[model samples]
Structures are given as structure tokens and as C-alpha cells.
Target: MTATVAATKAYDISGNVLKEDLRDIIYDISPMDTIFMTRAGRGTAKSTTHEWLTDTLAAVNAKNAAIEGDAFGAVARTLPSRLKNYTQIARKDFEVTGTAQKTSNAGMRELMAYHTAQASKEIKRDMEAGLLSDEPASAGTSVSARVAAGAEAWIYAPNHISVNQSAATTTAPVSGFATSPVTDGTATAFTSAGLNSMLQQAWSMGGEVDTILVGPTLYNTISAFTGIATRFRDVGSRQQAQIIGAADVYVSAFGSHNIVLSRWARATTVFCLDMSTWEVAYLRPFQTVDIAKVGDAERKALLAEYTLVAKSPMANTKATSMS
Candidate 1:
């Protein structure tokens, strides 16, 4: 129906007065899962360079008959070796202008508080990346920032296995720091056999494997392995049947492992970890502080000083350089 030629309509009015139709809720879909960080143990660190000691028992001998109690010979004793990693600082900061803070917002009531929370989450994500990265430890000079060795740097030969690695590229770090494995830029498909090999290596070293951490791609890849059975649920007439398509727990000869997926994990690497063998040493736990005001703005900083401790690197195994 058309309006009459002389009739006034709402569209004919200039600058119509109407309240905004914005919804009060805000939507965010960013992932914030830090599986490794959440599962690892926590400890306090007193100094910037945190240190821990590890010892190993002597190898077993098949022939130990000492002439049936002949003259007793003293055997040399071995001492525990000390391992150290420098603490790294991770931080995030945000500022909310005085005017913005006072404005009525649709999503959040307090601007500064919202930004502070966001900064905290961002720092956590940064730490997760740092802990899982292949970066080596460095006692930084005046010009560089100190770096803590990650799990990849500490995991060496006998525990660090790989698929399709170049010759002599997979070098173990000296004393669990200061070096990292070199990649061949080649990617190979992840296999159950490769994972089993890593698990076996750790088990042989007296490791009590309990968790298998992987990236999204490998997580899906493992779910499709033939070893994982197709799971079904029995339901009543009023219920819907459920089909479990993903493998959450993997059972092997070594042990049962809880498979954990991490968005921040390296796509080409998988860690078979005994959670007890690892720790995060924190010199300064995560905290927020207000910065000195220079203008009409409020600023805040979120930070933590932490380092990864491979209490017993041999107690963990990893498979790297895979697709």
C-alpha cells in the first residue's frame, strides 16, 4: 500500500530521534587453552638463573662375583650434575584513556579492568608459546633479553626421537641448555609407530608416561589411527545415541596416556611427558601493576618471570619434525 501524496511519513523526517539498537553483549572466540602450562607442576625460583641437580644410577653388571669375598675394592662414586636455565620475562600492557573509561560501553562496564584481564590472558598465551618453543637458553647481555630454554631444547638424544630428520641436524643441547635441535625443513606424516617408539624410549629410561601433548593437526591424525576403536554409547528410548569419534586416552604396552591438544604447541612435534618430571619455576608470579600516569590515561602492565625446569629430561620423550 502506498501513502497518500499529502500524508507525512517517518522517512520524511530529518534526523529521526531513535535509540541505538546495539546489543549489550560482546562476542569473542579466541582460543585460550594452555594444556602444557596447566598440567606442568609449579615451583618457586629465587634467582634469575634457576638451578637443579639430577643424578643417575650406575649401569647394571652381569658378572659381579667379586672372588667370593676377596679383598674389597672401593668403587668410584658419581656426583649429581647441576642444570640451570635463565628466567625469561613475558609481559603485556594496555591503556584506557580517561574519557574512554568514563564512557558507557555496551560490552564492558570498566574499560581499564577489561583491558587488564585481556593483558593477563595475552601474557599467558605468550608464556605457553615460550615454554613449548625450540628456543635455547641464553644469559642475555646488556643488549639482549635473557632467554630460558624450552622443552624442545632440553630434550636430547635417547629421549629426542624424530622422523625424516637431516644428518647431524638433531643435536642435543649441552647440559640441557644453550642449544637446540636443527630441523631439516622436511615434514613427514605422524605415525602410531613413531609415537610408540618415543613412548618406549621414555619407558626404558624409567619414565612413568602419563600425558601425550600434541597440536591440532596431529591430534586429529591420532584420532584416526586404526588402533583407536570406534566408540558407541547405549541409550534408552528417550535418549539420543552418541558416537565418540576422537581418542582421548591411548593405551599402550608402556602405559595409558591422556591425549591433550594445545593450540600453541608446535604443529610438527609431539611430547610424551611424565608431568612429574617437569616444572615451571617462577621468580615472579603473574601480577599486574599500574604505570605512572603521564597524561589523561590509565596504564597497566601484566608480567611474569619464569623458566621451564626439566627436572629429569630423560623421564620425557618427544617426536619432532613430523607432519
Candidate 2:
């Protein structure tokens, strides 16, 4: 598939080059991968790089849309929103602390906490069991309680993109991911002969997708090409949902028979081929480490621990943003 544009930047030896820069390459790792995470952290913290990234995403999206003649607004709105949400959530969690029966995450004064506190004050029945009692028909766990208690209310937001299924087997694939299919033009859909054509066009431009998520509609479309749809149905009947480090959306397409393909996306963690360096494994819902049962502390720790990243910024590489 087409190589992403950003990856083609000529080696910038302007940065500090060791006097003895003998450049012994690390096994199974990218040159930038060894430095981007730290660099990006430095970059984002600087504010300029972060602004550049937001703008770059916008420019790229606009250009892509212009060429395809599709509405760029969908992706334009999506990119900023996604980036803001990710950064905001990460920031809040990064500075959280709690102790004893009391707890505080982010700023306690945020108002969400106030409503929760108010609701808890009203939880007067069956303190020993620690579960909500069947005492009154008035109170419930719904957000309405918080709203009545003066908490602001908002709808449950929907994610813009979905992660397709790809085995998280040794490690979650991270690099050479969205690297494929870097073409600016867009095809309305990919199916039967159409997908092959898309792949060919992508190859003409460079490399394409490393993994993908396929809904039943798209799954059946790809199945006709791969011929593995029947094999998938015979054994794994339920959609083996994976809590991919990369995906924002859940693979709700359950059942082995009815399901056609897995939801996969670009990588969420550093896609290191060297398994030894990364002992951490991809998380699924009910695996040895089910993300579902994890408490806030555990979840934060989990995220901090396994968020494998190259030393430099992945943004330097073109990241795929779905519209």
C-alpha cells in the first residue's frame, strides 16, 4: 500500500546526534519509535506542536475531502472532537487521587462530584450491605437522581469510529497500521470487485490497512473475498469482542455464526514485534485481566502501564482519523 506522506520526511540529523552515532539499530523497532513518545510529550507540552497537530489534522482532512468531493465537515468536526476528548480524559485521569472511603478524581469542584455526593447522602437504607436498598420507589441509579440533585445532564455520546477485529495474539499491532491506503481519494464503498479495486488503487499509491473492523454488512462483503466466513461461524459463534487498546467503539456484532469479521483499527499501543520488551497483552472484556471489573485506580494503573508508545510522537506519522 501507499506509504504515508509524513513518514517520508528526510532524516533530520538536526537534533542531537551522538558523537559516536554508530547507529546500531534496535531489533524489531522503528528509528523514530524509540524516541517519538518522549518527543511528543515534549511536543504537546510545548503547545505549538499540539496546535500544529490540530491544524495538520484539519488540513489533511480538508484536502482528502476536497479530492473526493465528500463533505469534509464530518471529519473536520470529528478530528478536533476526538483529539480534545482523548486529551481531556487523559489529563483528568493523570492527576487523580483517592483514599479511604473518600475519593477525588480530577477537580472535585467539577460539579459531577457534587451531585454524586448529594445522591450518596440520600442513600440511607441498608448501609451494612452497601447496596442500594428496596426502601423507596422514588430514588434510582439513573442520572435523573443527579439531575434532581442539581447535576448537569447530557446524552450518552456516540463514538465516531469503530475498531474492527484483528487478533491481539502476541501483541496488538501498532506500527505499519493505518500506514496502508494513504491515498487521498475516497471510494464510496468497498465490496466484491470493488475492494480489490480499492486495494489496487492503494497499492498504486503505496501501502494500505494492516487491520480492519467489519460490521456484518462489510463482513459479508469481505467474506466473499477471503472465504473464511464459514470457518469463523462454525467455532466462534458469538462475536468475540475484544477491548482493543486502539478502538473507541465496542465490537457489538456478537455471535460466531451471524458475525462475519472482527473489528480492528490502527494500533492503540506501541506495536512492538519484540514480545520480551512488552509483557503486557491486549485486553478483552472477560480475559485474565477483564477491563470491566477494574476499579478507577486499577484502570488508571492499567492504562499507564500498558500504553506502549514509541519515544517520539505517533502524530509525526500520519494517524488515521475516521469520519
Candidate 3:
């Protein structure tokens, strides 16, 4: 009644298997909310054109009225000036090979989810960099031409006040709309008094600078400023030595400003902005496209066509050339 040896033996062909739960986790630290340009201004692009125009006017000055029964004196009519800037569209594409996904056996609904997020992050990173450029795009082989008329390209409009304590050389001004460039400072550090002075200057020009954008070093320096002291008392029965520290708002002679720590900001420069006067114009909102199939398993691209329109540099001033 015994069975054959072959019938009793079972072949182990498929090896040990473990459940493959795909936890597609991404650990890249990207600039998620660096859209400072759109934070304080209107973000509407009505036209489908590649370039957008903004009308500007100089501050109306107060003048003495004509004397009663005196000869009629004439005043110049205030005309609106136009500022033209080109829109920039950035794209990022990614493709996955057919075999790569086929061989990898994992419980995943979408294979291209990670790639899409990466492409979107990169496009946004580049946009933040472009927004902080010192020179607006010029008419060249690669860049667009300067804005028409006397308007400074958006880049030139921001305050570029140099605070170099050393003998810094000056460079030719890029446009009549921009300030002349100065060499970096040889000084060691930035002082609180210096920041106060800059704020005062902007205040004198009727600018309510409500935001102070600074780099890491400057942010740390400001946080440690003696002028910004914290005096709070804990009234619990069991008092714990909790170190509560943060410098969110800075009160200056001009106005109170929120602090923004930026890693993308240029070295030796700090921007003080009113926020109400800045704008981001978008010809086309961000979109993803599926190109015609050529040879890839799956392909997609992300795009954002946008431009920065600074309403007036007078509303924003920067302290530059500080070490």
C-alpha cells in the first residue's frame, strides 16, 4: 500500500516569498512655499500673449494752487507709463521603461507618481530662482529683451542699496530703471543699527515695509538681537525650564515687519517689502502634458508659464553688500 518515492516528494521551485508592500516614500527637501511674489499681489493674467504689460505712475507731488485772480498757471497732465516683461515657461519631463516596472513586483497603483512629484518640485525650484535674479532677462540669444520704455525690468526695480564698508568699485547701470551695481563688501557682519537705518530710509519714502526677507546668517543674527528680548513668565504649579524662542515680527521705526528666512536669496542682500505692491502674472497656469508616444513606456511633462511684475520698487527696498 506504499506510494512511489516521486509522488511523496514535493519540488520547491518558487522559493520563499514575502509580501511586498510598496511604501513609495520620498525624502527630498524642496522649497514648497516660496511663492513670495504671489503672496502680496494680484496673480491674474488675462491675455494669452507671451508678454504682459503693467501701467505705472510716479508719486503725485503736492504743489501750490493757483492764486485767486492770478494768471492761469498750467500743470502737466500725469500719464500712465507701461512696463513690459516676458513670461517664462519651464518644463520637466520623465519616462519609465516598460521592463523596469514589469519586473518589479510590488503592490502599487501608480508607478509614475514619484516621478511626477519630482518634476513638479524642480520646476517650482527654478521659478523661485528666476524670481530672485538681479538682472531681468535681456534681449539676447538666450534671454528676452529689456522691457520697453523707461521702466526698469522687474529685477532692476527692487532696492539694491549697497552697504559695503570697504572700497567697493561701482559698475555701469544696466538700465535707467535700475541702480548702479556695487562690489561686495569686505566688512565682517551686518549690524542691527544698519538694518534700522535702511528701514528708516524706506519709511521716509512712504513705504510701509511689512516684511523682512533675510538669509540664514542674517536671520540668526536678528533672532539674537538684544533689541528683540523675550520676557515671559510661566505660572504653572510645576514650572519647567522650557526654552521658548522665536523672532517672528520685528517692530521698526517705520513699521512692523514679518520675518522671512530664505535660502534662495542672494548673498549679502536683505529685502524689505510692503507686499501689497508685488504681483505674479501667469500667462498659463501649471499643467502636465502627455506627449505622443515615441518609444517610452510612459512619459509626462510639467510646465508653468509665468512672469514677475513689480508694481513699484519704491514699495520695496533692499540692504545689499553687507558681509
Candidate 4:
């Protein structure tokens, strides 16, 4: 009898079902894994509890930054079902790395691991280098960066950040926070084809995307699709009806949703924990991810995404004594 050899890592079947799983992953992200700000008056509700996320997003990545590509400014507003398409962007540039449930390894899971590895590397490299506004030190090298602290693009960028040997002016989490003039993105005409197009654009860039900020109308349109699980397809009457049925988990999360989320100031920033949705446990301002000047371009790459790398480190900067 021949023994069947198994692959150490597996993936989540890479299709529509995997797409649903991806949405679950994001949804399952479980809101920052740590201490969160509460609505001032009540002080009871744990809204965006980003436990150690303060450090993760502040973390960095390893995938070589492509100069001719998006260069880190590749955020998009699209439907949730389209998450799968955006993942393929890392095929050549970076790969993910992570741990698992010890027993179960699936196809989609393998893919996720690759993405994680890339993210971790990015965080490590960025942390050591001061956050700067430039292309990663290298153009298309295979070296991954670490997670550190500083801000190039914000929102997802860590709140407590410094620039060019400057002072830090990190953003605080929004409790009763509200954007000045809430303007909506392309939320009016959400078509099935449009969602797919948008997802493809993001994936082709670099899996550097962390969140998809959208308006209520756009959120409604995305939440309206389901059934096929994670894949994105044309939404017809019957399809939307089926997809809407499977959105119970997602819809429930948004039940308490208000119009305030959509009102983010175009220029104003929001506080974000830097660690992964999971790493909320061991985050400090200058811990884990650290920044250093190794050489020329290598250090330059590290500097490009500082806030991304340092969100979790708890470096020299001190957290406002939550007294």
C-alpha cells in the first residue's frame, strides 16, 4: 500500500466558498483583541476594542515594494464578496506566514499564511526604520520588511507616529468622535461588475490593503450579496436575494451601525492599533517590532512604512497613562 503524503500547509479551496471564508476571517477579526475606547458618557460599551492592534498595523511587511505600482497608496472601497480577488496580488512580490489550529490545514488557510508572513516581514522592517514618505528602499527585491512605527498613509496608519526625526502626534480613538464634513465615495450605483473590477484593482496592487472604508449605501450594497460564500459574481435579483439570506452574521454586527462611521474627515485621521487583529496581547509602544539603520536602501525601505511596523512595539513613546 502506498502512503499518501500531505502538504504541511493547505489553502481554503480558492473560489467562491473561500471568498465567504475570507469575509468570515475579516468579520471574525473580532474587533482589535484588546482594550477599546467606550462612548464617553456611558463607558460601558466596548466599541472598536483594538486590543493589540495598536501595534500590528504599526507593524511592517517584507514583500518588495514595486516602484511602478501603487507605492502604498492603494486603499479601495468595494463589496465584501470581492475579498478573494485582491489576494492574488501577492503571487510574485510577497508571501504570507502564520500559525494555525495545530490540526486543520486547508487551501485557503495556506494562502492566508503566506499573506501573514508577508505582513509580519513588512512590519519588522518598517519598525526599525523611521516612517518616511518614499518608495520602499528597494524596487523589486524579495526581502521582507519588519513592523515598526510612523505614518505614510493614515487611518490604518498608527495614531502615535513621528516623522523625519520629528515629534509624535498620534490620533486618539473615536468614541463620540465624528468627521467634520462626511462625504461619501462611489456609493450610489453599485453594480455586480463594478465590485469585481474594484477588487481586481486592489489585488493587482499589493495586498497592502487593511480595510475598505465605505458609505452606508455602499455597505448596504455589499451586505446585500451572499450565498456563494466568498466569491463575487454578477448580482441579479435571485442572486442578491440568496446572498442577503446568508448575511445574518455580518448584518448582526452592523445592527447598531450609525451614520457616524461614514462621516470620517477626508484629512482627519483616526487612531488604529498597529497589531494584527490577533496580536492585541503583547503590544507595547516600543516592543516586538524595532527600527534600526542597517545600511543604505535597506534602512530606507524600513523607513518608508514606520507607523505600519511599530504599532505593536511600544517603543520609546509612552501610551497616555489610561488613568
Candidate 3, run of 10 with poorest lDDT: 146-155
Q: Higher TM-score: candidate 2 or 4?
A: 2
lDDT of 2 by residue, 1-323 (tens): 98686663435443545243444332333111111121112212221111111222333354432556656454325442211100110111221223422542233443334433333323211121111111111122434321000000000001011123222111111221111112212223443343333223323322222323333345444444442333332335565744322222212122111221322212221111111111111121111122232344322211111112112111111111211
> How displaced is residue 234 in candidate 3, in Å?
6.4
- In order of appearance, the predictions have TM-scores of 0.91, 0.23, 0.74, 0.21
Model 3: per-residue Cα lDDT at residue 145: 30
Go through the candidates in order and give the C-alpha RMSD of each one to the true structure: 2.3, 26.8, 6.7, 24.1
For candidate 1, the per-residue lDDT at 240 reads 79
Off by over 4 Å in 4: 1-187, 208-217, 226-323
The CA lDDT of each predicted structure is 0.82, 0.23, 0.60, 0.26
Q: Please report the candidate that would top lDDT against the real structure.
A: 1
User: Please, what are the lDDT tens digits per residue for candidate 1 over residues 89-148?
Assistant: 998878889999999999899988888878887888889988988888988999999999
Model 3 clash count equals 2
What lDDT tens digits, residue by residue, belong to model 3 across residues 87-200? 566779877766654554344445576678777877877666667655444333345433211112232322444454654333323332233433444654677777786677
Candidate 2 at residue 7, lDDT?
67
Candidate 1: misplaced stretches above 4 Å? Answer: 3-16, 175-178, 229-238
Worst lDDT run of 10 residues, candidate 4, spans: 82-91
Q: Give the Cα error of residue 212 in candidate 1, in Å.
A: 1.3
In angstroms, give how far residue 321 of model 3 lies from its true place: 3.3
- Residue-level lDDT for 84 in candidate 3: 46
